[model samples]
Target chain A: MEILNALINITDKGAGFLHSIPALLIAIPLGAAFLAPILFKLWKRLAEIITGLAVTACLVLAIYLVLFLGNTPIVYTFSGGNWEFIQNLLPLGIVFVVDKLAAFMLLVVSILVFFAYLFGLKYLERFTGLGKYYTLYLLMFTGMIGLVMTGDLFNMFVFMEIAAISSYALVAFGTEPEELEAGFKYMVMGEIASIMILLSIAFIYSSTSTLNLAHLSYAFTQMQTQMASTPGFRAGFYFVLILLMFSFSLKAALVPFHSWLPDAHPSAPAPISALLSGVFIKVLGVYAMVRILYNVYGFSWESSPEVFTALIVLGLASIIAGSLLALNQKDYKRLLAYSSISQVGYIILGFGIGNLFALIGALAHILAHALGKGLLFLTSGSVVYRTGERDLGKLGGGLGKYMPWTSLTYNLGALSVAGIPPFLGFFSKMFIILGAIDLARVWDSDPSKPGWTMIAVAIIAGLFAVVTLGYLLKITNQVFWGKSEEKRTLKESPFIMVFAMVSLVVLLLAGGVAFFFWLKPELLGPAADVLLKGTKYGELVLPGLFGAGG
Target chain B: MLILGISLVLILIGLYAIITKRNMIKVAVGFALMEYAVNFLFAIIGFHKVPGMKIIPPILMEVKTTANVLSSYSDPVPQALVLTSIVIGLGVTAFMLSLALRIYNRIGSFDLDEIKRLKG
Candidate 1:
């Protein structure tokens, strides 16, 4: 009851403005990125120090927003007041809207990025062109935060391109022949996806003369009500929706569209591998799709059966294929990359289930995978940093005995990812299956009637859950605790590297335990409700719909 | 409708080249083709034409007399959007071209099939 009152009180103060908080989140990192080279020229180590300070500041701001905004969304127009003044003048202008979900993603992105930067501090010592690397890193960082915050469609596209372009450069940052090949492939696929999305945006802008997300959703809802029976309108509308979904799914790397992930992820440096696997796909792919499809276009399993069914099929295929393919990998990072694909399957599955618990489960899985896979990748980087080798066959032999910190953290990550208890991944995977069962029971008409489809989905997911455990265990045994191989001068990683790994482990443990006690109900619940509320999103973001379509 | 048809045809040609071509440079060219097609589509979307309506460029020469500029001219927002999109596309094309050159320098082949070093 107290929490509800606090939430209402926050929402009551809806048009809260606090001195340009939203713009600074994007501008700080971007300014830092642009200035990094100049700083590098001035002093050798000042660029790194400034980047560290800037990212930490962003993280602080994100955490502050999560607490201060509470549950109500705050929309910031550049003019520092309510959007009503511009509502009558220009139909749409640059707006930054931060709601529960956006806040949650900001938190996740900031946390991961801060740690990734810390990890990169020591990790990039041997690499050349350190200034360019930091520049691209901060640029990608700015792009991720901006895409989530902006309330304009074309703005979102621009940020998406910024992130994509930087990531392509980062993937090939290693500059090996294989790394260049992977980067080129990733760029081509990403370009095609961006073009499709832009084309769809053009279609939307043609139908409605506004590019603002709030106005667009309002217009869409109005149009659907007015022309619900017009076949031509419906056909064009669904066509646009289909194009948008296809492009986003390609970015998300769902099933048939998943060729680039396995290649791009392994080719990058470890911290980047962590970022690409952790938040990049979730932000640029799944997050954008969910916001546009569910909130703007108003997709529901009942309303959009074809779309939901396609999602389910794609999710299932990714799970089975990603895991099975992971079984045959010889390289360590490649296997982890394949595992990432399968875990993304779990997130897609949760989204397709289309209920509260499922949404929460999916959101939780995003955080879990970011932490677990991030820890695993950083550990891989530490191993490579210690000894320049990556093959499981050549690099075995009781590695745990020498590096206790890496071994213990790696084991914890493996257990969590495999969905073991007292760890975060277990709860998320369990909630998704439970959500599936609830959906199945609700959809079935009679009490005694059987729900075969949802039941089969749950069962298949559960079975593959075991397969996930098997492969993780196999890899863990091979990498950390196996027969001795070639001996050399190798010790635990440097202090800074171990410090980053330890911090991740602590987060993983706290997140898992906090799942039962607090975070599920308070944080994830509100975020999921934003999705569940659907087109009511318009009301929350934009106060009125009268002048939306002009 | 004719403009839309032309855009689709342009996209298909680029798709065919991207799918069937073996040379890296050809793939890059195909990408450029697709970029222009999408840009052209955005330009078409922003355009408005009535059969008898006068066509005028969107300029503010007579701001007081023609305050309601929207009714007098075709929309220029999509034109502005396309301009920005085209510049970004050029950046992507240049980057892709450079990457292809680097790959050629390292692997000594423009054929994608021969550049099969990192496979399962």
Candidate 2:
């Protein structure tokens, strides 16, 4: 009850004019990305130190922002707040609104980014031209935090482009023919998705005449009520939403739009891979889509049942197809990449159920999958760095004897991702199942009759958790354990790499219990409330929507 | 509606080129075509038939802002949005073209088929 009180009973607290932190969050990374090359030219070591400091600073600000956020969001309007003559509030100019949901996402992005930077410090030492790599990497980092912070639609598009373009460069950073091939393919698909997203933005801006998210929500709410009866307006309105969904799904790598992921993810260096899988897809794709659909458009299961239903269908396809395909992979990294698709399917499914419990489940899955998959990828990097081999069949057999830290952490990650007990992933999956069951109960109009379809969805979702175990354990059975004909000289990774992996595992272990304790009130509850409250977000941002549209 | 129809046609053309053309250069060209189409659509969104919109730019310091300027602005917000979007497109294009050049140096051909070394 106390924990619930923490989430529910949030006061503005003392952080009133401390609103400039949001701008600093974006500027720190952007400044670092631009300065990295010059700093490298002056002293090779200095560039990385600056990058480290920048990422750490961002993390500090994000943590402070979330705690300071309590319940009411921190609204920072660029240029508008600094000048009085302009007279800008929510309706005008670019706004950065960091509500509980955005703050939650901000914390997630900064955590993974900080660790990935740590892992990369040693991992990328072998590669030459370290300057540009750090530059592009930081840009990707800024792009992520920027998009998450922005409450303007066009600003979101711009940040999406920044992240997408840099990732394309980073994916091919190794410069091998195969890496180039993967990068090229990823660029094409990503650009296509970008154009589609741009088109969707244009369509919305044309209709609403406002790009600010709060105003769009106000305009959309008014439209949903007033013009909803007009068949022409309704169809066009829905078409815009569907277009946005398609473009973001392409970025998210959900089933049909998934080809780029397996190629792009594994092709990048390990830390970059971790960033892409653990955070990129979620922030740019899932996070952005959820923001538009729920907050901006004020969609819910009740308001827009078919949209939820469509998402459920997509979620199921990705879960089944991704898990089934991963079972056949020989490359360990590729196999992990495929399962990312499967896990994302689970997250989307939880959201598609579109109930409060389901939302909590979905948000938990995002956090779990980020930590679990991130740790898995970092471990994969350790293996590759030491052996320079990625093939599971060729690289394998009884390797755990040598690399104890890597092996131990890998097992914990696998166990967590595979949804075993006492780990964060298990709780996330458990919450989703409970949510599905809750949804099923509500799905049936008659108290006497059970909702058969939703019950099946619950069972199917639960079974896939086991399927997650199946593919992940293949790594244990094949790569970590088993006898080999050859005995090769193997060593545990450097202390730094091991340290990075251990930190993530520590997060999965202690963080799981902490999340459970803080579960209802502090973190996920208010964040989920942002979705459940729906159009209330617009009202919160801009009170009295009366003449606000004009 | 005519402008929207034209943009759709351009989009279809771009998609066709991307899907059917085997040359890497042609694929980049296809992407540029789509970018142009999308940019054009956004800019046209700003080109209202309101008087003085074409003759006088709306961002001038002299012009007094009106709340209803949105529906009536001759050249409005989408124009600025398109400019930013176009610059982003330029960044993406430069990256893609440089990558293509490097790929060409290694393979000695710009064939998409040759780039398919990674297993599906």
- Models 1 onward score TM values of 0.94, 0.94
Q: What does the lDDT read for residue B78 in candidate 1?
A: 90
| Candidate with the greatest lDDT versus the true structure | 2
- Could you give candidate 2's per-residue lDDT for residues A85-198 as a string of tens digits? 433334566678889998889899999999999999999999999999999999999999999989889999999999999999999999998899899999999999899999
- Among these predictions, the greatest DockQ belongs to 2
lDDT per residue as tens, model 1, A1-550:
4743553443343543332567778778998898887898988699898899889989998988877775668776653356555553344557788898998899999999999898988889999888889899999999999999988899999999999999999999999999999999898889889989998999999999889887788888789765688888888998998899889988998888999998999999999999999899989998998899888877897677778778778889989999999988888889989998899889988988879988999999988898998888888898888877888887875788778898899889888888888888998888889988998888798565457789999999999989888877766788788757667566898888899989998998999999977779767888999999888777777765543443
Cα lDDT tens digits, model 2, B1-120, are 999999989988998999899898899899999999999988887765655555544553443568655444355688889999989989888888899999999888899897787884
Clashing pairs in 2: none
C-alpha lDDT (0 to 100) for residue A117 of candidate 1: 90
